[model samples]
Target: MVVLKLQSAQFFTAPCEIRSRKRGNGQKFSRIIRCGIAEASGEPAPLGQKTKYNDGPFEKVFMTLFAKKMEKYANSKEQTKKIGWWDFLYDYERFVDASKRVMQGKNRMQQQLVVREVLLSMLPPGAPAQFRKLFPPTKWACEFNASITVPFFQWLVGPSEVVEVEVNGIKQRSGVHIKKCRYLENSGCVGMCVNMCKIPTQDFFTNEFGLPLTMNPNFEDMSCEMIYGQVPPPFEEDPVSKQPCYKDICSMSNPSSSLCPKLLA
Candidate 1:
């Protein structure tokens, strides 16, 4: 058996202000703002272990079953290559089809067992039994904030090797700075612009299950530039007076040509 271990440390923080779109009333707008600091350190275990199985006939049965299901989708050589052996077994389509069969009073538990067997057949050869423990479901949530003084190395010149990456307002300790850019022309947005962004998760779910579902924006409806800044003003918004907040900055019609002044230096 081969084992590998890894460890790393990192720090990040951001201050965010969320503004809600105004209702019909003329009252002043109320908003919630959050600021916080976050840091973490951890060591990671090696990826996976090897094991052996004695059930040869059962393995062949699962391989045949999964291949039959994949035949419908595997048209070209490129498609076959893209659908790896493991995916042929548990691809979302198979899951939904089996679910429907179960709901229709077919061999429910037995069909599920077939799916599990197919997955087991796809595991890398000699994988350890303990590998099953690694498949447990998990969830995560986090928040952060912070500020800083200066470092000693700013004095050095002549093509500095260090790279700085900043996200939201927090900068990374090292590596080339990566700034988010707008997806659409004339839109001062980065990462993802709600109007232009297309997430594949919803399509994957809908296509496999024949269900119509759309993943919508979670926050208030606002221009992308407000959430993620970009180089020049991408596009113009409607007039300020007509908008929920009657301030110049709130208007989408008039976009400022000024680049982020901080980046200029």
Candidate 2:
């Protein structure tokens, strides 16, 4: 007989004694399994039978991996901030250069170049130059149609027809509207949107002109995603009228005629 002891939830259990069975070779073998939580005093608290193994190596490996990942995450975050200014400048310069190159060409190539130029020109001036430098002309041009030109014109012209609705005795203003989109190609979209909306002008650091010219990267595609998302699909039914709402506000109404003469023309 062999005695095996284990700790319970709040107390120790009586030793469980088991007699070993003899094998054909006249040797006796016995197996004992216990399950429970360890007690406060560092004793095993058994609830039932369980398998056990050494976990020290696994714990050490996990800790090492976790530490490495954390270090990498911190390093990447720092790198992003450090590269932000340079990336913005590069994108701005590339966009300007590409536009010039496209303008000097002709035919289908010229049409594509014009579209690219228009889209790039629409972006905020502080986009990361690194990202712009990476874009192929085809992608840059296509992105402008899908994300930039469409969305900006949509917002400038308004999303829905203005119909007066009264909230109380006095007339109240309410209409379906698209909020300005933020750009996130580089650092993040919120920062770009703040600059576009000119929110930072309230503080002296930004000044009445907002960010200084040196800090400006002139990202023309900052609002691409924003405009793309807000600009209703050409095939989608209008929410208010249940009619096809394919017409772009800017193109149809010319709301941004004064602001974007190049586009209007």
Candidate 3:
């Protein structure tokens, strides 16, 4: 008799096939069948058996990729404090802690720009050249949102609304409303979200894909709004840049005065 082991929640996304034999006929069949996104319904976490990440092939692969990329940039220059050793990259929590530590000493603007540079280093040169330009920015944004962004984050944030919104007499081509951000909540760092995620991510999509995006994260609920094809306003005019940090922050620093200089006391 074969001993069956429990699977992890991320197993559904990995490319794996398991064979199970029929007791009576000895016919072999697949234990888990790959699925199409079109067939799934609202807020469903399907095809997941367990929650432990150790057994999750997909999670392992993604974490490894992210870690390697970070390693490349973290060691490239000794000008800043070393974030983490290559050996520590496999663990997400460890990486986050190290990243925050490396970013903590810098001012608000410097923190955002430093993280932005790290993200850009991970992208291939001439990236948007690969994407066909026959479509408008809005169309391209929508397609990318469906195929990549939404799918990539859905598992972490559950179901979210991908919307189109107008602000300041300008219409955003695409927008994604995250009811809650898992990374920010889990990492418990506002600086990490702004510097490592929001600013850098926005710059990456805008520069690489020629699609501008502005991410507005609500600290109270950990919700966020990603508006695509809309460039982030200047620091002087940006509300988020001027917003105060959470009264209680993970980095143990003041956001209004330290993290966000534009936000006056």
Candidate 4:
């Protein structure tokens, strides 16, 4: 009996299947398949499992590259601070921590502006123009954009799927529904999610790339929807601008205030 140990979670003994395949050396390889995670406990698998990354080598490379880029743009002075080499999740947490540090001593508008610059710095030369030309505000363009966002951004946002949304009276698959946002969960700060992520991302896609994008975040569950081809409202008009802090999760949360203290900073 060959044992196929799962690295993620415990497997159910009854809901499993055994299979065999012959290798090139005439060796029989035994494989076991368990019932899908949905039927059991919804402990979602790691993002790397859904990609071509074998044993997390590619994930480590990508995470390291992105983390260095963030630190470079955020002007992080702590050169001695190092993100985890092998632990991608810990690296992500460090990345968010860097973002929070960027917001220190900065007002609301300045925070958003600096984060937007960091995002633009990460992109290649003329990427904004290329994206604008490739993805115009059309049904097919929006749908295709949504489909690609799932795999391309799953590392940062976690598991997400393309969802259908109505834009300008036309139904299109231009929405990306995130199961749970990795950044928000890691930071646990409403201000970080808004200034560092939501506002900067919206500005990057809409202004820089010429593709109007809106992000609607559910602070209660940490789920979010990214709708391409939809213009994000101004901070003065959007309700998220006045959103309260996460009382239990955020260390800087002010329970007495109705709105996030950082929102007024």
Model number with the top TM-score: 4
After superposing candidate 4 on the true structure, give the runs of residues whose Cα lies further than 4 Å from its correct spot: 1-55, 73-90
Clash count for candidate 2 is 24
Cα error, residue 166 of model 2, in Å, equals 28
lDDT (CA) per prediction: 0.25, 0.25, 0.53, 0.70
Candidate 1 achieves a global lDDT of 0.25
Kindly list the per-residue Cα lDDT of model 2 for residues 1-265, writing each as its tens digit. 1112111211111122234666777776665432111233322223121212122222223323322332322212212121112332222223222223332223322333334333344356744353334432232222332332222222121121222222224332222222212112212222222222212211211221221111111233222222111222221232211212112321222232332222211
Tens digit per residue, CA lDDT, model 4, 1-265: 1123322322331223445787778776766554222323343334222211111333445556666655654544643345454443335556666676677777888888887766777789888899888887778787777877775565576667789898888788899998777778777889989988898889888899888889999886788999998999988898898899988778878999999998987
TM-score of each: 0.17, 0.16, 0.63, 0.76
Give the total clashing residue pairs for model 3: 0
What is the full ranking by lDDT, best candidate first?
A: 4, 3, 2, 1
Q: Lowest-lDDT window of 10 residues in candidate 4?
A: 47-56
* Candidate 3 positional error at 172, Å: 8.0
lDDT of 3 at 258: 48
lDDT of 3 by residue, 1-265 (tens): 1112113332343323444656646675546543212222322232221122221334434555554555444423323333323443344454454465556456666655666666556568754566426334665555445334554554343335667677446654467887566556656666567767787777766766666778888876777888776788765566666555554545555644644332332
Who wins the lDDT comparison?
4
- The whole-model C-alpha lDDT of candidate 4 against the native structure comes to 0.70
Worst 10 residues of 2 by lDDT: 1-10
Q: Candidate 1 lDDT, tens digit per residue, 54-165?
A: 1122222443464454333332222323222454343223322332332222232333333344444556654423322332111100000000101111111001122333
